[model samples]
Target chain A: MRIFVHTTYNHRDYLKRLYAKIVDVLKDSGVMVITNHDHEGKEDLTKSEIERMSDAGENVLDKMDGIIIEASVQDSEVGYLLAYAIAQKKPILYLYEKHSGAKSVMGYFTNSKIPDSVKIQVYEEPDLPAILSDFLHRIETGESKDLPTIKFTLRITPQIERFLKLKAKQYRTTKADYLRDKVIKKYMEGDEK
Target chain B: MAKSRSKIALLFFGGSGIQTGDGRIFEVTKKEEITAWLKELPELGILADIEPVFVFGGPASEVTPALWSALAKKIGELYPSVDGVVVTHGIDTIVYTGAMLSFMLHNLGKPVVLTTSPLAKEMQSPADSEGLVSDYRNLGVRANLINALQVATMNLGEVVIMHGNRVMRANQTIKSIGPGQNFFEPIGEGLLGKVDFGIKLFGHVRERGKGKLKVDAALDDHVCTMRIQPASHAEQIARMIASGCRALMLRSYSTLPYPQSFIPYLRLAQEKGIPVVCHNLFALKSTRANEEYILINDMTYEAALTKCMWVLGKTREREEFRKLLYRDVAGERIKANV
Candidate 1:
C-alpha cells in the first residue's frame, strides 16, 4: 500500500524526529511512503518534479491508499489538506501528540460531520508504531465499515455490456465490481464538476 | 449594497497559471475548460469580471522580444475596454517581461500587473517542508492571483510585478536566489507598493490619468551583456563587436577600476560606431564619461539591457542613442550620472 505523511512546522526538532520514526515504521512494513519531510537528507524535489506534482493536483492523493497527518500543531494548511484527503476518500489516520499544549486545528472537525474513513487518535510517542501498524492492518483487511450505497440503473449499448462482461470474466470479478473499481471509481476521482 | 467589480482583462501566457481538474497544466486548447478552471476559484469572480484572453501556452523562457511586442500590442487593444490588465507569466522570465512592458507600454493609466505562481522547487526548504507542502499545493498560486487581481483595480499606473507581498516596479526588479518567501527583489528603491491588511500605494508611484496609452514596442534584441573579471580579455569584447553585436553592456567591478585591457576594445567599439554601456560603476568614485563608453549607475541590469534593446531599435546614431539611453524612461534610471 502507498501512503502520504504530512505534519505541521511547529516544534521543529520533535516533529522532525517524529517524522523520521513514522517513515521508518512505514518502510519497515514494506509499504511505500511519500512524505513532505526531508528525513534522509534528500534534496528537495526538482523543478520538473514540482511541476508534475502541481499539475497532478488531488490526483496525487488519489494514488495513495491512505494518509497520515500529525496534527499536534494548529495549522490551517493541514486542515485544508485534511479536507481534500477526505474528499478523495482516502483512509486518514490523524495522530496528535498527547499533551502537546498547542491544540490542533483538527479539533474543529469534531463538531462537524466526520466521515467513517477518518480515525482521530491522540497518542504518546511510544504508541505511534503500534497505532500505525494497526491502521495499516485494518486498511489491508478492509476492516472499516462500508459506507452506505445507493442503487442506480443505466442503459448502455450492447457492445459496452459485452465488453464489461468479458472484462469482468477475465479479471475474475463480478460486472458490478468491475464497473465500480475500473469505471466509476476513476470517473469519480477525476474531473469532478 | 455592493460595489461594482472591476473588469479585468486577464492575458493568460500559461506558466504554472492554471491546473486543470484532471491533473494537467492548462494548455488553453478549450475555452470552456478555462472557464471551468476559473470556476474552481470563485473568489476571482467576486474580485473582478475577468475576461481571459489566451496569448500562448509554454514556459516563459521561450518568450522572445517579438512576443513581448505582441503582448504589448494586445494589452494596448484591451486597454480601452478593461479597467485594468493582469498578465499571468512564468516566474523564470516574468521580471524581464515586466521590465520590457514597462518600457514598451508608454502609459499614464491603470495598473498593468504581471505575476506568476513560482515553481515549487524554487521556494522549497527542507527545514520548512510543512509550509512548503501547503504553498506548493494551492496557497502560493491562489494568493498571488488574488492579489494580482486586486492590484489590477488599484490606482497605480505603470507596469509592476506583484509577487509575494511586494509590488515592485518592473524595471528595477531583480531575480533572487535561495528559499526565501520572495523570489524577486527591487534593485534600488524599486518597491512601488505592498499588500498587507490592504493594498497600500507609495506616494512615489505613478497615479492613474497622466496621459493616453501609447505602444512603443520596438525592440532590437541584438544587444549582448558580459561581466568583467580579472581574467577577462579584450579579444572577447572584440569578438562580440566583430560578430555584429549592436550594443554591449559590460558589468564593471564595483570596487576595482575599469580593466585597462578592455580600454582598447572600448575605443574599437567607438571607432566602429557601436555604443558600449558600462553598468555597476563605482558610485563613490568619479569615473569621467568619455565618448568611448557610457556609464550607468543606480539602474538594474535588466533595465540597462532592455533599455539598450529599446534605444537601439529607435536610433543607432551616436548622439541619439546616448540621449535616449540616458533619458529617464519609465523611471528605469534614477539619475543619469553621465
Candidate 2:
C-alpha cells in the first residue's frame, strides 16, 4: 500500500522527530513513504530538496492509496496539499500531536464540512504507529471510503449559469472546471466547503 | 389577531431566565413564583401571547417521570388551543426531556420547542454580586425565551431543542459539554435549521402524520443506561440484572460486544427475555456481530435510552422488541442502506 505523508516545511526542528516518528510508526506496514526525508536532526531537507519535494509529493499522492498528514504545526502549504488530496478523492487520515489546545485545530480536519474531510485523530508519540497502522488497514479494507462518489445533476438559474460562464471565461477556464477548482480552493482555505 | 400571530403554549418548568424565586431573595408558591416571573416579562406578550403554564420548579435534573407525564398531558390538552408549544426547561437534562416527549407524544404536528440557558450569573449569585443589578431584565436569557416562543409559532412541527442559536430534532440532538455553553448537536448531520433572522428552515423537518395526535404517557422509567468501557465490570451488570430494571441501554464502544465477562450476564438477560439495547454506536448496516448478539444503538444515546423506556412499556416479546429498535420512529435512526 502506498501512503503519502505531508508535514509542515516551516518547522525544521519539529520534523526532526515527526519524520523519525512517522518512519518508526510505518516501519512494518510495507507502505511506501512518499516523503522520504533524511531527518538526521534539524538539517531536515536541503532548500533544493524542498523544491523537488512538492512535485514529488504531488506525484506520489497521485499513485498513493491513502494519505497521513502530521498537523502538529499549522502551515498554509500543508493545508493546500491536504485540500489537493481531498479534491483527488484520496482517503486521508490526519494526525495531530496531543496538545492542550489540539481539539480546536483538530475539528477543521476531522469534523470538516468538506465532503472529503478526513478522520482527524490526536495521538502521543508512542501511539503514532498503531494509529497509522489502523488507519492504513481501514483504507485497505475500504472502511475509510465507506461512501463512494456518486454523480448527480443540480438545476440552477439561467442568471447563475450566465454568471458562472462569465467568471469561467474571465478565469480562462470552463465553468465546470472553475467550479470544482474554486470550491476545492475555498474549502481548503476554510472560506467554504 | 394579526395574520402572523401564533398562539404559543409556553409551558414553564422554572428553568434559567425564570426567576422561580431563585434569582431573587423571596419565598412564594411554585405556581405564584412562576406567574410573577411571567408578569416581569410583559414585553413577551408582544412576540406571542404566551399562556404561561407552570409545570415544575428547580434545575432540569429535578424532572421526574411524573413530571414528564404531567407535562405531556398538559401539552396534549393544550394542543388544540395553541398553534404550538414552547417548553422552558433547565439545560441539565433538557435533551432527555426532549427525547422523552419525542416518544411520548405521537402525531404532534405542532412545534414542541424546548429551550433553556446556562445558570446565568444572576441565577447563581445573590444580591451582593454585580450580576443582579444588570440582570433586572433577566439579562438576555428572557430574550432567548422569546426566541423559543417565536420558533413555536413558526409551524416547525417537530420536537426541537432551541439552544446555541440552532434548532435540531429532539431525538437526533445531544447536549454539548462546556461551561456556559450548552449547544444541542444533531447526531449525524448539521442542524435542522438556524433560529436566526427570518426563520430559515433547513428542509429537515419531517412530514407530520395525517391523524389525530396520540399521547402515550406510559413510559417505564425503570430503564437505565450504562456506557461500556474497556474494564467494564460484569458483576455490576449481573447485579443490575438481579434487581435494577426491566431494560437497559448499554452504550458500547463502537457498537462492539461487551467483554467476555459481560457475555454471561448479557446471555442471562437475553434468557430472562429482557431487552438490553446496545446503543450510541453508528451502524448504517448490521454486521455479523450485530446479528449474532450485539444490538447496535444507531440512534443518539438520549433517544435510545428514552425509546427503551417507551418500548418496554409496549412489550417484552423478542420479535416486537427487535422490530421497534430498527424502526424509524420520529426519524431517529440513521437510514439503513437500501
Candidate 3:
C-alpha cells in the first residue's frame, strides 16, 4: 500500500529516525512510504521550484491510500496539510510523542469533530516503529474499529410486549426482528415521536 | 380543569443515534414509522395534535446554514396554524441547530424543542423472560423524542431540548463532554424545567414577544472557525482570510492572554473587513479584555460556532455583523460589558 507521511521541518531528527526504522520494517513488505524529510524546501529554491515541490506533495497525497502525520511538532502548516487530507476522506493516523507537563497534541480533536478514519496514538521511542507497523497491519486487515457501539437497557410494559409479539406474528418474523422494524418505522414515520 | 391540547409541528432532520442501530448499520427510518410508533402510545394524543414534517434525512454533519434557513422559513409559514414545534436532529449538531433556530425565530411566542437520541437500540423479549417485563424496553431515542414533543405542546416560548425529563434552554445548552457524558447540558443557569410528574418551569424564563413572528433567513455562507492552540500557525489564519473567510470563530482553550504573534494576523483579517469572535471552550474564569478590538463574549462553544454561521448568513457588514454577534438573540450570550 502506498501512504504519505507528513512532518514539520522541526521534527527532522524524529523523521530521520522514523525513516531509518521504517526502511528496516519494509525490507520485504509491499508498503511504500513517500516522505520528504526536507519538509521545508531549500531556502534558495525559486518560486517555481517551491510551487513544484508543493504540487509534488499534493500529488503524493492524492495517490496515497492513507496518511501518517507527526503531530508532536506544533506547526500550523502541518495543520493546513491535515485539513486537506481530511477533506479527501483518506484514513489518517496522528502520531504524537509521549509528553509530560507540556500539552498533548491529542487535545486538538478533544472538542473538534472527528472522522471515523482518524486515529491518534502517543508513543515512546523503542516501540514507535512496532506500533506504526501494527497500526498499518490492522488497517490493511480491517481490524481497526470502524464505529463505536452503545448499549442500553429499555423498559416497556406487558401490553406493548404482547403488541410487539402479535405484530411480529402478523409480519411473519421473530419478535426481535419485528421490534427492529418498528423502530426503523418510527424514524420513517413523518418526523414526530 | 382540563388543559387545551396544542397543535404541534414536528420537523425531522437526521441525527446519528436514530439513523443507526448502536451506531452501526443504517436502520431504515421513515416518517410513517415514527408516526406508527407514536400512535402505539395513547398518552401522546392527550398532549397535542401531532403534525410531523419529514424535511430531510442525514447525519448531523449534513446540517448546513441553508438547511437552517429553510427550517426557519418552514416554521414561520406554519406557526400561524400550529401551537408549537419540535425538531429531531443529530446529537452532534443539535445545539448548533437549536442556537441557529433561536436567533432565526428572534421572539418565538410558542415553544420550539430540539431533541436527539444519543443511543438507538433494539430490544428482544429477553429469551423466555416475559417475567422481566415492565417499562424496561423503552429506548432513550423514543423517550427523548416523546419528552421533546410534550415540551413543544407546552408553549415555552423558547427553543429547548427535552431529554428524559429535563428541559434545557437551547441557546444556553452545551454538549456534555468528559467521561460518560452523552447529552447536551444547559450552561450557567442550569436546566429550565423538569417533567417529574408535571412540567415544572423554573426561573430565567424571559418575557417573550407578543406580536408578529419574524424569521431572519438571510444568512451569509462565507464563515469558518479556527482554533488557536499553543503552536497554531498565523500563516493558516492569513491563508483563511485570503481565501475569503468572511467571518472567523477564533477559539482558544480558555480566555488566557492570547499569543502576541496572532495580533498581526488579527489586524490583517480586520483590515480585510472580516470580523473575528474569540470563543473560549469550557470557560471557567472570566475573559480578560486584552483583545478589545476583537469582540469576545461568553457563549456555549456550540452556540458561538452556530451563531457565527447564522450571523454570516444574514449580513457580513462590520456594524450589523458585530451587532448580531454581541446581541443576545434569544438569550444565547451572557450579559457582559463587551
Candidate 4:
C-alpha cells in the first residue's frame, strides 16, 4: 500500500529524526512511503512539478492508500494537507511527539465529530514503530473499517458471471473477493467526485 | 467565536494551472458544478466566500488585450460587492495579464491577485514517481491558492502575482529562466509581499479601501516588440511599420552606445511618426530625453510592452503617446529623476 508522510520544516533535529524513524518503520513493514524529504536514493520534487500537478487539479493525497502526518510541529501547510486528506476520506494516522510542547491540531477532532477513518496517537520515540505498525495493520486488515463492510446483493447475468469466474480464477481468488478488491476498490479510488 | 469571511470574486479565466481532474479548466458555465467543486475544498470556504466569475477558458498564452479589458471591467463591476478578487491564469502569460490589469484597473481599493500553476516536467525514471506525490503535499496549486486567497483578504490593495512564497507586483514581474524555487521575480522594488508563516507585506503597497474602482481597459495590440542583437537589421523595423505596427518597444543592451546600423531605423520610425520605446537601457550619466525613442530603464519587459499597448490604445498622436507612456499609469515604472 502507498502512504504519504508529512512533517513540518521547523524543529529540524527532532522532527527530522521522527520523520526518519517513521519512514523506516513503514518501509520495514513493506509500505511504500512517499515524503518530500530526499532519502533512500529518492530525490525531492522540484517546485515546478508540485505546481504543475496542483495546476492540473491533481492532489497527491488522492493516490495514497493512507496518510501519516507528524504533528509535533504546527504548520499551516501541515494543517491544510491534513484537512485535505480528511476531506478526501483517506484513512489518516496523526502522530504527536510526546511532551514536544507543541500540540497536535488533531486534538480538535473530538470523539463525537471525528470520523472513524482518522486516528490520533501520542508516541515516545521507542513506541513509534509499534503505533505505526498497528495503524497500518488495522488499515490493511480492514479492522479500521477502511474497506467496504456492509453487504449488498446484486443479480448478474450468466455472461457476466462467467467473466467474473474467469477473472477470479486467473487471479487465484474467490469471485466475491476479486470483484471487491479489484473492480469495486478501483472504481471507488478512481471516482472523480 | 467565528468571524465573517471575506467575499472574494474568483475571476476564472481557464488556465492550465487551475484545471480540474476531468481534464477541464475551472469555468463557471454551471453554477451547481462550480458550487460542488468549491465544496470539495472546504479550506477555501474557510478562507473566503469565493464567488466564481467566469471570464474565459483557455491557456494563458491565448490571453489577449480584449480579455484583459473584460477582466478589468468584471473587477470593476464586482468591486462594490466583493472584498477582493483572485484571478486564476496560466503561468505562461500570467505576468503580462497582471501587468495589463495593474494598468487597466484604475484607483483599485481592493487586492487583485493573479495566480497560476507551473506545468510539471516529464518523469525520467521510476524513482522520479515518489517526488511527484511528495511534492504535491508540500507545494502545489492548493498551497498557492490558499496563500492567494489569504492575500486577497489582506489590508493591502494592488495587482500582484502569487506563486510559491513570493507575492510580486504584476507589472514588475519577470519569469525566472532556470530551475529555481520561485517562478517569478519583481523588478525595481516591486515585491508587494511574501507568504511564509503568515503574509508579510513590504512597506510599498496600496492599502485597501483607499479609492473607488475604475477601469481604463482601452488597449491597442498593434505594437511591435524587438530584442536588439549583434546582427540586428533595420529591415525588421520597416516590415513591422509596413504591417500596421503603431508602436515599437526595443529590448536593448543594458549599457548602450546602441549599434550604429539601427540609427537610420530609429530615424525611420521617427519620420513615419511611429512611437519607439527603448527598454533596459541604463544611462551612464544624466542624459537629455532623446526625441527619437523613449527610454525605459526600471520596468520589466512585460510591463513596458503592455504599457506601450495601453498608451497606444489611449492616444495615437506622437507627443501624446510619449506623455502617456511616461506618465506612470500604474506602479510599472520608477519615478523619474528631475
Candidate 5:
C-alpha cells in the first residue's frame, strides 16, 4: 500500500526516525513514500521551503492509499499538514509523542476538544510496525469500531449524581434507562454522523 | 371609589452623559424621563389617568436611602393607589437589581419594569432620552396586560422581562458594538416581549404590600454562561469543569453548524455533576444522555427567557433546575407548540 508522509517544523530528525519505522513496518508491503524536502539536505530546508511545498499541490494524497502525519513536535509543519488532511476529508493516521507537561499536539488531538473525524495515536517510541499494522487492519477489515472514541472525563460530585438520579426519577425512569433513551434517541437523529 | 390609579414609579440610577464602552450607564435620562412623552399612550387609550413617579441618579447609585424614599414617594404620587413600579437603570447591574427585586417581591401583584438605553446622552443632543418615550409608553401598556410577577430589563430596542432567577450573563460571551445594545446578537435567538404597565388585563398584579424581596448574592462569579462554538477544544471545557463551577449555561448554536465540540464538554459536565443548560441548538446524535441535562429556548425566543427566569428562581439544585429548564414557558416549551 502506498502512503504519503507529512512532517512539520524542524522535527526532521524525528521524521527520519519515524520514516525508518514506516519502512520497517511496511517491508515487502508495497508502500511508497513522498516528501517535499531534499533527502540528505533535510537540514538545509528553511521554513519558507516547507510552507512553499505545502502550497504546491503534489498530488501525493490522491495517489496514496492513506496519509501518515507526524505531530510530535509543538507548532510544527507536520501538525499543519495533518490539519489540512483532516479538512480535506482524507483518512489520516495522526501520530504524536506524549508529554505530561505543557500542551502537546497529541493532547490536542486526543482531548475531546477536537472533531471526532480525525483519528490519533500517541507513542513514546517510534513503533511504526504496531501503528501501521493496526491502521492497515482498520482499512482492510473495515472494523473501525472501538477505535478509542472520545469521552468527557471530569469527576462528578456525589451531590450531582444524586441530582441526576432525582431528575431521572422526576422524568419517570431510572437513571440508566433515561441515559439509554437519550443516547439512542440522539444517535437516531443523525446529529453526530 | 378607587382612591387612586395604578401608581407608576420611575427610578433612574447611575445615569451617565458621556460615551465609553461602559457608558451604558448613560441611559438614565432616556429611561427615567420617558413618562413626559406619553403622547402615543393617550391616543392608544392607556395611561389616561395613571399616576407617575420619577427619580434619577448616577450609574453608581442603586437603591439608596434618599433615593429609595424619593422613588417611593413618586410611586405614591402616581397613584395613592400606586399599584406598580417602572424603573429605568444602567444595563450593567440592572439584572442584579432585577433579581433582587424579584426575590423580594415574590407574588407581587404590581409589575416593576426596568429599562435602559445603549447610547450616551452626549453622543447626540438629548440622545439619552431618545428611546425613552417608546419604552416608557410600552411599560405602562405591558404592566396593564400581564399583571403577573414581572422583572424586566431592556437594551437598544429589545426588552426582556426575565423571571428573577433567569438573570445570568454569557460570561465573556456578551459583545456589543454599539452603546446600550446587547454585546452579542441573540445568535438566532430573539426578544420575547417588553414590559408594559398601561392596561389591567392579565391579573398578574398582587395585593398591595404583600411580597418580600429575597437577595441571594451567593452566585458571585461561580456561575457562568458560554456559547459552544465549532472546533472548540476540550481543554477549554475541561478547565471550566475543573474550576469547581456550580452551574453553566451552554448557548448552543441554532440548528446552524451546531458546534460539535459541545458533545464532549457536555459529557464532561455530566461526569463532573455540574448542571449544564443547553439553549438555542438542536440535539446531536452522540450527545450525552438527555436526563443528564436540560434544554430550553430551543427555537423560540420568548419561551427561553421566561422559562430560564422561572427555572433560575426555583432551584440551585441541578435536578430541580433541569426539570424547570425543560418545562414550557409562555406555552413554547416544545417545538410542536411553536
Candidate 6:
C-alpha cells in the first residue's frame, strides 16, 4: 500500500525512527508499502525547482494508496496537498506527540472548526509503538474500533443509573455495550464527561 | 408557620465523612466539616435565608458521578429560575470542571462559579472557604452580566471571564497582564466567548447541540506536527498518509499567498477519503478540493472546535459534523471556510 506522509522539518530526526518502526510493524501485514521518503528530487532545490518538486509530490499523491500525516507542525508547508486531501474527503490518520503542556502547532485548526474527515490519535512517546501497531492492525483488518480503554469507577447515583439505563434503551443497545462504548468513545473523543 | 428562606442551593462535594470548624485543610473536606461549613453560610448573612444543598464526591473522589449527578440535577431542577451555583472543588481538575459546567449548562441563566484553592479550606489564606463564600455571594449581586457560553476561571485575587475565546486572568480591577509577572498571562485566543444571557436559550442551547461534557482526566497523548517543506516528496507524504494517523491539521505557510504546490495531497485525500482540515487560507480559494472533502479548522484551541471535532468523530452523522463546524456563536462568524 502506498501511504503519503507529511511532517514538519523539526521532527525530521524522529521521522526516520517512526518510519522504520512503522515498516517493521506493517511488514507482515501482507501490505506492500511505498513511503514519502521514497520520492525523488527533494534536495536544496530553487524556487521554480521547488514547484516541480511539489508537482512531483502531487504525482506521488496521485498514485499512492493511502495518506498519513505527522501534524504537530504549527506552520505546515504542504497546505495545498493538505487542503486537497480535505477537499477530497480522504481517510487520514493523524498523530501527535504527547507533552505535559502541549504547545499546539496548527493555529488554523486550533483557531477554527475541525473538519469531519480526519481520524485523530494521541500517543505518548512510550506508547507510540503500541498505538501505531493498533492503527496498522485496524487498517489491515478493516475493524472500526474505539480505543484507550481507561477504567473509570464512577460513584453512581440511582437516578444516574436510571439515566444510563434509559440512554442504553433509547440507543437500542445493551447497557454494558452502551456504557462501555460511550466511555471508550468519550475517552477517544476527549469529551468533558 | 412562615415560609423558610428561598432555596439557595449550596452543593458541597467533599467526603462521605460528617465536621466541626476544623483547622486542617484535608480534615475540613470531610462530610461533617463540609456540612458545617455550608451550615455556617446561611447564618453569616451571606446566603441569607437561602437553603444550602451540600453534595459530596467522597473525601478522596475528585469528580465522580455523584458530583455530576448533583450538578445536573440542580440544573434540571432550577432551569430558568436558578439563583446561582457554588462549586467548591479540589484544584486538580477545577479549571476543566469549570469548562464542563460552562458547556453542559450552556443556556444557564444563573451563575455557576467554580472556585478552588492550592491551600486547604482550613488554611489561613486571605481567601479561605469563608472568603470564597463571600466572593460568590458578592458575585451573585455584582455580576449582573456574565459570559455564560464558556467557563470563567475565578480565583481569590482574580476573576477572569473569557471573552472572544480569550481568557483574561487578573484581579477584579485589571484585565491585562500587568507589571507584576503573573503566571496567568494571556495565552492563545479562546474559540467561544461569554454567552449572552439576554439571547433566548433555545437557539443558543439547542444550536450548541447535545453531548457529554466529559472532563478529560488524562491528556498525555502525542500530536506529531509537521510543516510541508519545499522539494517535499509525495513519497514522504504517502508514508505519512498511510502511517495510520489520528487526525491531520494542514496549515498553509502564512508567508505564501497561494500554496499551489501542495495541491496533490487533495487528490490523494480524495482517493483516501480522510478528513483533512485546512487552516489560515480561504476555503473558496482552495479550488482543487470540494466542500465534503475539505474541513475548515477555524477556531482557537481554547474554542470547542477541537473538542467538537473529537465529539463529531463518534456520531452516525459524522458527515454532518462538517456542517456544524463553522456555525456562528457568541457573535462570532465561525465558518469552516477560512
Pairs clashing in candidate 1?
none
Q: Where does model 1 exceed 4 Å of error? A: A1-193, B18-33, B120-134, B137-139, B281-287, B335-338
TM-score of 5: 0.36
Model 1 alpha-carbon miss at residue A104, Å: 32
* DockQ score for model 2: 0.01
Ranking by TM-score: 4, 1, 2, 3, 5, 6
lDDT of each: 0.71, 0.63, 0.61, 0.71, 0.42, 0.38
**Per-residue alpha-carbon lDDT of model 2 for A118-139, expressed as tens digits?**
6778777778777888787777
- The alpha-carbon root-mean-square deviation between model 6 and the true structure, to one decimal in Å, is 28.9
Best by DockQ: 4
Interface RMSD of 5: 30.8
Off by over 4 Å in 3: A1-193, B16-43, B120-139, B178-182, B207-210, B253-257, B281-292, B336-338
Positional deviation of A99 in candidate 5, in angstroms?
A: 96
Model 5 per-residue lDDT tens digits across residues B1-338: 01122234434454322222221323334454444333212211112123333366555334433343344345334423444555655555544444333332323334455544333454443334434321221112222211111231111111223211121121111223433212222222222332110111222222234344222222223544666675556567678877876666666654532355556776778676677766653555234435545655443332343334445555667778777566532223344323
Candidate 6 off by > 4 Å: A1-193, B1-7, B12-23, B26-33, B39-45, B48-74, B78-81, B89-99, B120-298, B305-319, B329-338
Mark the regions of model 4 whose C-alpha exceeds 4 Å error after superposition: A1-193, B16-36, B119-135, B281-289, B335-338
**Scoring each candidate complex against the real one, what DockQ results?**
0.02, 0.01, 0.01, 0.05, 0.00, 0.01
The iRMS of the candidates, in order, is: 13.6, 25.0, 24.9, 9.6, 30.8, 27.8
Q: Candidate 1 on A97-186: residue-level lDDT in tens?
A: 887665444433422445667888888889988999988987886665553255679899999999999987654346876687656755
Error of 2 at B221 (Å): 2.0
lDDT of 4 by residue, B1-338 (tens): 02345788987775423334332323333334556556435546545667887787666667888888898898899999998999878778899899999998888889999887543222222244333322333335666777777788878678999886778889878988744346777767677776532457888887887577788888999999888888778689888989988888888776673686877887888888888888873643226336557787767788888888988888888889878877886788855421
Off by over 4 Å in 2: A1-193, B1-4, B18-29, B120-139, B178-182, B207-210, B283-294, B336-338
* Model 2: colliding residue pairs: B279-B297
Q: Over the stretch B31-89, how does candidate 1's per-residue lDDT look in tens digits?
A: 45566556545445535678988786667778888988999999999998898899888
Candidate 3 chain A, poorest ten consecutive residues by summed lDDT: A53-62
